[model samples]
Target: MDSGIEIKVMNPRRGDNLVHPVGVGHATSASSAPLSSTSSPLPDERGLRQQQQQEQGLRQGQQRQGLIDFKPLKKWVPWIVPGFVLANIVVFVITMFINDCPKNSVSCVAGFLGRFSFQPLKENPLLGPSSSTLETMGALEVSKVVHRHQAWRLISCIWLHAGVFHILANMLSLVFIGIGLEQEFGFVRIGLVYLIAGFGGSLMSSLFIQTGISVGASGALFGLLGSMLSELITNWTIYANKLAALLTLILIIVINLAMGILPHVDNFAHIGGFLSGFLLGFVFLIRPQFGYVSEKHVPPGYIAASRKPKHKPYQYVLWVISLILLIVGYTVGLVLLLRGVNLNDHCSWCHYMSCIPTSLWSCKSQQAYCESIQYGNQLNLTCISNGKSNIYTLSGERPSQAQQLCSNLCG
Candidate 1:
């Protein structure tokens, strides 16, 4: 009875189906026992864990691919700087043709290379235009601008140059300095700064240089330098090595200004341009990074929640002051220019502002002068007339006698 009860229980546990005969019970037990032992949960769990890990790795790779890569981005090219260069070259070519620039002549080439490529300053009354061609082309002239109300010269003269070397030097400097500024600030802002600064330089030149025909892009270039300083100061946080950059810029400005102390350089224009650019820099070139937390780390919801600018209070104060000064400067400059304020009348000694004082660099009311010429032991006086290339010779034994004769004839 005990053996029968055990067999009945084992048969039900093995298989309850009618298809299995009584003899097949041992076979079923043998096959099912091995299957149950081999099929453990550990292997299945390991496979599942591997699949999950692969999926997680794939998701991580996708996220990395979605991130922005700033390395491959191309740098912005500045067209305005090149445009200014081309325009300057074109104008220079036209001036050369107008001046009847000689071809393949040593003295002519040398003159163009040096200072005498154009006519003498005193030959043109009131240190008028460098040449008749320049005057016709609207070169800046104190008498013409003040007396005739050709206020346009203030803008036009910035494009004019005295000689080949002069234009070459200025255009090179423009390309060097302007490209960087335009690249950083975009063309529109840079363009505005350049034009306004140039105008400011011209206005200042008119005020201080009361007796000369001034031309060239030096003032505009100086303005660019000034703007660079203001840019550095305003965006101090953004630049790497702030102190080094500031020191370098300051050094460049000082060196250039020192060059102005030399003869015939327009220092007033440099100062005006620099000052205008410095003031305008505070107004126009403020960077987005200034006085603000970087947007990359901020949450979208938090950024949207704060509608106010993240700028410091000092930044706002600077902006207001800069705008006010710029507006006032433009207003005052235009008013004074239109009113025909004769700076010469008000400041007779103002010519000294443009030139250094020395025995050789003395100011003259008339252009004519006497030059001593030596022919062996005998001395001769050459009387050079204003606006005329004709040389008159006064022959004499003594140098003093010859000088007296030249004074009588030339003066």
Candidate 2:
């Protein structure tokens, strides 16, 4: 579902440029006598010196304001996005190797790849590993994380991809959105946004989607998109053509979120990541107000009559509100999750947000029941729903494992 698009950044113009003192020409013209009158007397040395000083201050203020308006902070070398890409690729390769689909099942797609072959299409249409393989590899499973104290899955799940298409879409979006933000804001801030937003996404997914394992970087990608929108708004005065940029970003976000409505797509993660990143944007992406002067720009022996505030009042309000919301949301979510509270029980209509049932396909969770009987060296599974039977070598597989296989067959 991921597609790349370029964002247009307009040139910044100083909105408050008129407030600065007028230039020397204006001052001289005002001081001169009218054309019909006799010529005015020459100004004194002290008066001339004062006028020159005033002009210098005016020029300095204009220069500093121009820098504030037009110049961006030092650009950061874009290694973080590339590094994340490499890390995700490495993890996917390792996952494929460990999956060894050929060894696990009687048949596998693309079997010529040996251990790297994908699970049967019926099992994993994403062209990746089986559910058992992903589960063992630290997919985000609510029961395991809550009952077994395997909390690391929250972080680990972000690096895991469900299949080839999943990783490709996510990584491409990451590169497109992430690199620019990193270059403008530096890696530390951008990295924090990615990780924290991902965690937030996982937390929400765990609460609502309790039946299956969830994996992918879609949440984090949405977080970056969320940050972009908030950054545009909070730093509203600095950018040119603000309305157009805002609308373009909104369109992109809306399209992406709409895709989440498809069956099997996790929209909770998208919403959670977006909300967290939006708040974080207000806290982290704030910019100085127009016409603000930095101390470094002040000339020796010159004191400004008055100074502009560094940030607008609205920015401060947003920062405080967002910070508080982030903290409370995380705390309340963690407490509820640990307590094993089922969110669906409280909100009857919430499930529809993740998926809407349609005539072409059903959104109900498939829970296939099957009876398994094991002989000395073989196992037989009979699906209760359709009375279909399949046999496989016992091969040390557990009861739960047999059930999963039967579920796939029934599906």
Highest-lDDT candidate:
2
lDDT of 1 by residue, 1-411 (tens): 122111111212234431221223233333332223232334445666688799998786555433321112224679988998999888876775655422211123325433324333333222212355676677888788767889899999999887666887898899999998888778888898899899999998877676657888888899899999987887776678999899999999999987786676888888889989998888888765433444553434333223346555666677789889988987887677667665667776765655666777644444336666555644455567732222333333322334334434565
Model 2: how far is 351 from its true place, Å?
0.7
lDDT of each: 0.67, 0.82
lDDT of 2 by residue, 2-26 (tens): 1222122122235621111122322
TM-score of model number 1: 0.66
Clashing pairs in 1: none
Give residue 76's error in model 2 in angstroms: 1.3
Where is model 1 more than 4 Å wrong at Cα?
Answer: 1-75, 101-130, 290-310, 342-353, 358-411
The reply for model 2, stretches above 4 Å from the true place, is 1-70, 297-306, 394-404
